[model samples]
Target: MACVVALLAAGCSAHATEAGPEITAGPDGVSISIPVQVTVGGMPAGDQVRVWARTYDRRGQLWESSGEFVTDGVGRVDVSTAPSTGGTYTGVDPHGLFWSMRLPENEQAPYPLMDADDVVVLLGVDRAGTTVARTTLRRVVREPAGQVLPIAEAGLVGDLYLPPGAGMWPGVLLLGGAEGGRPDPAYAALLASQGYVVFGLAYFGVPGLPTTLARIPLEYGLSAARWLAERPEVSGDRIGVVGTAKGAEYGLVLASTEPSRFAAVVAHVPSDLVWPGLGGPAGTQTSSWTRGGADVPFLRSLPARGASSAAPNQAIRSADAYERAVATASRWRLAVARIPVEQITAPVLFTSGDADGMWPSTAQAQRALETITEAGNPYGSALLDFPGAGHLVGGVPDLPTTRTAIPYGPVTIESGGDPATTAAAVRNTFSATVELLRKAMPRGRG
Candidate 1:
C-alpha cells in the first residue's frame, strides 16, 4: 500500500503503543486487526503504514523494500512471511517506531533460506476495510566481515544448500564485480559442496543499504566481521576474506584496516585504492591497487549525494568521466595507502594478471604485494601471478578472469574460467578461508 514506516514515526512503535493493534504472525504471514493508529510528529493516522529496513548480501549491501505493511481501524496488520526467515529486519515508522526481527537460524544451521535480504513479508492492515494499508520494506544490512558473515547475514534470505552438520566448516566471503552480491550465483552451491558455510552479500541493493559506493560505510564491513568473530560454530579467529574488482577494494579495506579480524585475505585481480585516480600530474596513476604506490587522491566528491564529480555511479558506470574520475581516484586511493600495513596484520593472497585492461599499470599491484609482505605482519602474504588474466581471473592464458581463493588456478584459468572452475574457486575460497581459520585457531596453531 503506502509507507507504514512514516505512520509509526521515530520513538513510536506499533508494539509499544497502548492503542496499537495486536499483530500476530505465522509461517505464511502476519495477521493483525483494523483501526491502525500511525503516529507522526505526534499525529496519528488510522491506516496505511510503511517502514524502512536494511538487508545484506555477499558483495556488500543487500536491498530495501519500499512501502510495506498497512493498517486498519482495529490497529491490526499482517505479513506474508515469517520472522524466522533469515536477514535482520528492523522497521522504523514515520514517527520513528522501531522494531527489529532476528531469525533463530544461521547459514550453516541447516536452514533452507539462501539470503536474509531476499525475504520481505510485507506488513499490512485492513484499513477499516475501506482501503488497504500498504508500505515498503526499507532495509539496511552492514557486512564488516569480508568472509563468512556475508552468507549468514545476506545469503540466508533465500533457500540455499548448506549441508546439515556443516556447523563448523570453515566459511568464506566471496566478493563480486561492481554490480552487487547475489547468493544464488553458481558459486553458492559449489561452496556448500566444499563443506564450508558461506555468506554472499549484496550491501548495495538491500532496501535501506546504500546502492552506491558513496553510500557504503566503513563500519558496515566491520560489523559483519565482528558478527563472524562472535559466532560459536565458526572459528572467529580463523575467518578469511576473498574479493574481486571493487569487492577486492573492500577486501583490502577490511583486511588492512582491521588486521586482526581476518585470518587471511584472498584478493583476486585486486587493485589497491578505493576511488578512481587522476593521472599523476596530467597524471599517470589511474586506479586503487594491490594496495600500494601512487598518491591516492582524497575523494572529496560527495557523489553519493548526486552532487559531486565522483558520484559512485559516475565514476564506475559512466565512461564519459573516465579520465576525470581516474584523476580523482588517484588522489583518494594514495591517501588510503598511507593507512599502514601494520594495521593490516592479516596474511594476504594477492592475485593479479599481468595483462589486465582494467588498470593503467600492472606494476602497481606488484608494488602493493611487496608492501604487504614487507610490512612484517603476523600473517602470511603472497602475490600469485597468472599469465594472461585481467582484473578478474582464474582461467586460461588468454584473458585471465578469476581464481581468487578456491584454487583451480591455471587449470580453471585454462578452461576460459569455466563455470565449474569458477564455482570451484568460489568453493576453494571458502575452504581455504576455513583452513586459514583452523590454522589461526589457538589450538590449530599450537
Candidate 2:
C-alpha cells in the first residue's frame, strides 16, 4: 500500500497535496487490488473531484474506470471508503472497484491490462471535466520471464511457454473453452513466467483436427500431457492441468481417466456432470467427447427459451434461459452425466461464478465438491465460489470484467457478472491456483 502519487494542481489555482493510491497485491504477488486516496489543498471546499484510471493491454487496447467524489471540509477525497453513486455502477462499497477494469456500457470489446509491465493511470478531474491532478501506479509483479514457441505434435496444436531458467520445471497442460482454435498463449505465458512449463493445448478446430467439437477424442489431452512431460524442460511426474468452461469438463474427465499422470488439477467454471458436446448445430444434442472410440455419456439439451419480449435486451445473457434448459433435461442428465471424481487421485481446485450466464457452474462445482467428499479421497479438494461473477473465470489477468456479446457458436452469448466482482474473482483465483499447484506439485519433486 505504498503511496505513489505526485501532487500538483491541473487547471485550478488550488495547491493540491496528492499522495497516489495504494495498489495491494494478492497472495501470489502478481494480481492487484487498489485502495485510492486523493488529497487536495487550497481548493473550493465542497467541489466535486472525479477520479479515474486508465491502462492498456499488451495489444494496446484501453481499459478504464471513473468515479466522482465530493470534497470534504478540507478538500480531500478517499476512494477506499467512498460511496460511489455514479460512473459505471452505483454502490456504497469504497475501494473504487466500480471503475477498475469495467467494460463500458456500449463497448463491444474490452481488453484487460495483463502483466506487471502494464501501468495503471490515475487521474483527478474537476466537475467541468478538467484535469486537476494525475499519477501512475505500478502493478505488483514484474515483467513475465518466459519463452513462447509454437508446437504441433501428435494432433495437438498450440504454443509452449517455458520459464527462464535451466532446470526442469513442473508442467501444466493449459486448455481453453469451446472457442475452437488454439488456446490463448497469454495465460500459459504468465504461468510459465511464474515458474512452470505450460503447454497451451488445442485438441480441435486447428489444422489436422476436427472443425467442430463433435465427438473429439479425449486421448488427445492425454497425449498432450504425455508429450509435455517428455519435454526436456518439464517434470514428467509433477504435472497439472488448468482448464476453463468446456475445457474444465475435459480436465475433470481426463484426470479421472488418467489418475497417475497428474499431481494437481485447477478447473474453473467446472461441471460435475458430462455435458453434450458443443460446436454442433445450435440446438443439437450429441456426445462431445469419446474414449476408445465410444461416446462419453452426456446431458441432453432441453428446449431453449426465446429472448424476453418485455426487455428485448440481447446484450444480457439470460441466466434464466440456461437454467431452464438444464432443468428440463432428463433425470439421466444427473445420473449418467456425473463426472467420476472418485477416480481422480490428484488434489482438485474448482472455482465458479454464482451469476454465470452460460450455465449453473456454481451448483455443479458444489456437486463436485460433495461427490469428492463422499469418495473420502486422501488427496482432498476445494471450491472457490464468487458471488456476482459470471462463467468467465481464470485466464489472462486484466481482461474486461464483462463481455457484452461474444459469439458462442451461432449465437452471441453474454457473460453476466458484476464487472468489479468478476475482475477480483479472476485475480484472486489465479493467485490461489498458483499456490495450490506449488503445494501439490512442488518444484523438483518429480
**Per-residue accuracy of model 1 over 281-322 as CA lDDT, tens digit each:** 322333333223332333322222222343222212221232
User: Of the candidates shown, which would achieve the greatest TM-score relative to the real structure?
Assistant: 2
Model 2, residue 83: distance off in Å is 4.0
Local accuracy of candidate 2 as per-residue lDDT tens digits, 1-446? 12223322242323433533222222233433323343433445676666666666665666677776676676655565556567654455443432355544654452223532434544445557777565565443333455777897666788888887678889999887877676655566667777898898887888888888878888988899888888888865658999988889999999999999988999999888777776677657778889989889887655335543323336445456546756777776667877898899989999999988877889888989889889896786899999998777776555556454555544556677777787778777888899889998788775
Estimate the overall C-alpha local distance difference test score of candidate 2: 0.71
Write out the backbone clash pairs for model 2: 5-20, 112-398, 277-288
Worst 10 residues of 1 by lDDT: 405-414
CA lDDT, every prediction? 0.41, 0.71
Identify the candidate with maximal lDDT.
2
Candidate 1 wrongly placed segments (more than 4 Å): 1-167, 276-339, 394-446
